[model samples]
Target: MELAKEIAKGAEEEGAEVRIKRVRETLPQELQSRIPLDKVEDIPEVTLEDMKWADGFAIGSPTRYGNIAGALKTFLDTTAVLWKDNLLYGKPVTFFTEASTIHGGHETTILTMSTYAYHFGMVIVPVGYGIPELFQTTTGGGPYGATHLGSKEELDEMERKIARFQGKRIAEVAKKLKS
Candidate 1:
């Protein structure tokens, strides 16, 4: 959630209105009670209308077996109506992710998520070494998109920088597209 906030911060800095929403949790009540979700409890669950309202998107998720998490995937799978209606076509979109290990599929998660953008005909805006942090960060951030390592609550400086850059870049692109 912190990483999403950083991305939203960058977008807001770039003059884009942002709304942060989380996919609905799919875990059983018993399992959900054990995990800490206080940070996101107040975040509204994302809806099809929100998806239609945004000019662009910065979708974030935690890696699940080197792919997009099931909760996010389930939410995305419900977008066929939008897809059929062509609501997301030509809009810019970016991706971010978190992983438990260095090789825990950060890039793969982003890459897999990009498939959604492709299907929706949204322009994929990747980081592409646009910032020094991408090259320097030992922990997270990459050409695919902003990323973070481990399940820590706080992002490292480099991770935050890269996420901000991605947010700003996407907002700029979306603005240009709008104009």
Candidate 2:
């Protein structure tokens, strides 16, 4: 999604290595194989190995009734091995979500996902109020990380701007923690 890319952009600008992953699609043949999706090599499937290799995380999903998407839930569920190994312990993490409307569970999704981070002993990195966008934004984003509204595949000016703030924040935190 545009918001996801925006967050990555934010981190990349701060010198963080960015990799994008998507949960395995369980959609039907037609829905899953759309033209753009046919290029699967560009966006690799999210794997536990990817989790193991990262210093930090920014997980985003489409809200499903104030909760995370089942696809993402399923992906996370497979990380039992990581949890047991403490593979992600104390790593920084953040989240973002999208919905069709303003109140479409962005906060809840980001907040709820933090429990998973907690389970892994990861540090929760909220976007926080340091960014002016948090105080003045009329669209997505809150104390949680970057957020976006609308069905567009790309972020608008506000969402992109705020996402940059989130990306920089995450990069700073992850950089410090990594050192």
Candidate with best TM-score: 1
Q: Which residue runs of candidate 2 sit more than 4 Å off their true CA positions?
A: 27-42, 151-154
Error of 1 at 26 (Å): 0.9
| lDDT, model 1 | 0.91
Location of the lowest summed lDDT over 10 successive residues in candidate 2: 32-41
* Model 2 agreement with the true structure over 22-140: per-residue lDDT tens digits: 88866576765542455454787988889999999888887878898777888898999999989999899989988767887888988878889989999988988877867777675
Pairs in clash, predicted candidate 1:
none
Per-residue alpha-carbon lDDT of model 1 for 1-179, expressed as tens digits?
87899999999999999999999988788888865678799999999999999999999998888999888989999999999999999999999999988899998999999999999999999989889987788776889999889766689999889999999999999999988
Best by lDDT: 1
CA lDDT scores, all candidates in order: 0.91, 0.83
